[model samples]
Target: MISVFPEVSSQYLIGGEWKTSSKIKEVRNPAKITEFVGEVALCSETDVTQAVDAAENAFKAWSRTSVDERAKRMKEAAEKLSTVIEEHVSLFVRENGKTMVEAKKDLLRCVEVMSKGADTLLEWWKPVHVEGQAQKVQIRKRPRGVTAVISPWNSPMILTFKRAIPAILAGNTVVIKPATYCPLTVMSCLKIIESSFPPGVINIVTGSGSVVGEALCGDTRVRTIAFTGSTETGKKIMSLSSNSVKKLYMELGGNDPALILPDADLNEAAIKRIRLGILRASGQVCSAIKRVYVHESRYEEFVDKLKKEFERVVVGSGIQPDTTMGPLNNRSQFNFVKELLERSKQIGAQVESIGQKLDSASWEEGYFMLPSIVTNLSHDSELVRAEQFGPIIPVIPFADLDEAIEMANDTEFGLRASVWTSNETAAIDIADRLEAGAVFHNNHTVFQNLRLDFPGIKESGLSQETRWGGLELFTDCYGFAD
Candidate 1:
């Protein structure tokens, strides 16, 4: 029962203009597979070249613009965007399959990030003086020319602009290639902010990643690549950018964990993660809590409560007033989660399909999936070890804190993890020992304080996405004798 976003244009924003392409793609509603949201342009490498060239040409002048001016423009755009925010939010739910609540958060996050990125410029750049030998030295920060922001489709607009906002605010021209699955949402976002800056300062190129991604990462004109996607794709970007040695800022995949200690609020800990972290975005979040480690004393009790919570979740179209969860964004993701749940059961794990389809007759025709909860899974099972990127989660019981930490650290990814305990000392101690880029003492989510650096350890990522760290990421040191 969702209305189509009237102006989901199937065009590219290049050099401050909306350009059309011969090649086209369809943007479909995941909740109603046959329904087309709109047609989108499938740009080729040539299109990417044009976009990058525009950005490169603009960067020389853009980099010269004062930080104060850049911040002011972004602030103005944020205010302008707030007025038409509902239309954009609807686009996200229609195309991205985010629940109403989740869509609102994504839209708000985009605005907040833009506003925050602007405010950070107030303190982000500073000159350092170094008295070396006989001459005084001034270390200055300069923009890295054209920065390409390659964002993922899961939370398309926000993820793309989250990086682009900083790059632009730091005086670098930006060319963004949002995921083809939801390109128009990103385009719609760009359309609002496009007039806020000089022509060619902000651009959105839509197409298959193979064509556009290769072009962006491989383009020598693009000096920095801020990418967010799978770790495998991150590796490809690294190799592609190696020739130019482009500065790479990547926020990749994570198999985040939630560790519940004894004496914790078992229901709150489990339900909070399930509702806010895993079930949000249909568990498409890069930092979603994929694994859970519960203390032996509360293991059985926690499992019972967690199972009950999943059962109460109403799964249906995001537009439904009562729907608490929505469909998987696409088929490949749905298939992967479905297969993983089957494999866990085959491997002797206690797999329970707490899934009761809300719109049963039409659910399968679309990508709607009932949230599945797995218990008694080995710490080494695929479900526990890999990121499902869906509403399915595996709960593992641990005997002690030592075993919990050891089990948690056994993943190839370290994006985020949380420990639950009423003991303030124990919570802090546990949080300190985790290997994630960020750890929460009692709660976890991808949302971060805009002023703090949000980066991951191990393979989770290679750069920061928050205020100061974000600004510095797009700059190169220009040190000279004063």
Candidate 2:
């Protein structure tokens, strides 16, 4: 049983102040849809203007601050945030439907990313000197003024902080718009972070994408748009920002693939890690494994192991101590995943629900779903092709390595892929051939290093996030000579 938590009322942060509006939108817990979580201000276009105005006014002074000073401020902010990261864990779970463990990790990652940004700031901004016979030229980086950071619902705080912090540390003032579905926790975290910055340096607005998104992208004062969402929304941002030719850094949707070669070992330990990669956060991660390609010789063995692993998943409220998996974040996503499973079955795919419900009596009341293992799916099947963004995954068999490679690269997205094999050399070869932003050997789902540059090709994304190359996208290069 879950205890009732106090309802949270969120307000817009503009010019270093919390501002409220007449228009209000209610937020409900996906784990218990009838339970009210809180309300947020449904900001209009006027609110967008005020936030951008504040950001634009502050950019001049912010951009002129010494790099060392900017880094110091960000470092201090990270230190201050670390002390209170644990306080917001429950609020995050109720608002986002992520397990308590995941929520804690997410908040801690926010602190880690901010600290890394401060540590790397000085080295990242050193001017490059170009010498010629005539004159010496120095190339320096300048911040793009008034960056609009639009973050997604899943892992909102970390994603927003990763982009917004770097943009601010780079000397850019920002106007942020957190996802409408789950904004309370993000808003709460931002309020703590806002105290570290000066007035107008960090501003936030909450509203529908149609009203607020249009305002920010269409505004001439917003010089850069840092967005993370669906590919369709990414396209709309590009079209809207084209008038001003704003610099765009987007990390969109992905249908990541995982390939298991015949020579690979399928032990319980390996299967557990694979299960976590597929079902973590109820498979809400954009880079999660949506499709699996197993060698024909190992298909039956792989399927049996995966199915057994799924059986251990416990579906219930995120607050439950024994719950391994939680509900979908919202009603629309729940409907989409349910419908996708039904349609896949209708088309002759074998979709089997393989998991336990913590409370069968109250199962239908919430947005809870069992982890499903799908088989008998063709390369072009809807379940195999689409980004389900749920715990359901399609495991397709391939006759040979060539067939596996061909099938994996057939998707419209290329965010991540992995190869499993006993031979390290063979794994590397297959990883090199796969079409994805990042590839792993023997394991999938985790990013080992954040400093490396990993930009997805095709529609997966533009630029990257939270490190050496990713931070560079928030600025512009200027060459100087005397």
lDDT of 1 by residue, 346-449 (tens): 87887777745778888776788787778877898788888789988888888878999999999879888888888889887887888899888667765567
Q: Candidate 2, clashing residue pairs?
A: none
Q: What is the per-residue lDDT of model 2 for residues 1-482, given as tens digits with 9 covering 90 to 100?
A: 11244323658988988887778887788889887888777999999999999999988898999999999988888888888877788888888899999999889888887888877888889999987638878999999899999999987987788789889989999999998888888877777777888899999999999999999999998999989889999999999998887888888888989999998889998888789889989999888889899999999999999999999999999989889999999999999999999999998889889999999998887899999999987889888889999999899998988988988999878888888888999888888888899887777766755555454778988986545735688889999887
**What is the Cα-based TM-score of model 1?**
0.94
Model 2 clashes, total count: 0
Q: Clashing pairs in model 1?
A: none
Going through the candidates in order, what is the number of backbone clashes in each?
0, 0
All models: lDDT?
Answer: 0.82, 0.86
What value does the lDDT take at residue 327 in candidate 1?
Answer: 89
Which window of ten consecutive residues has the lowest lDDT sum in model 2? Answer: 1-10
> Where does candidate 2 stray beyond 4 Å?
1-8, 131-134, 452-455, 465-469
The C-alpha local distance difference test score for the whole of candidate 2 amounts to 0.86
Report how far residue 302 has shifted in candidate 1, in Å: 0.4
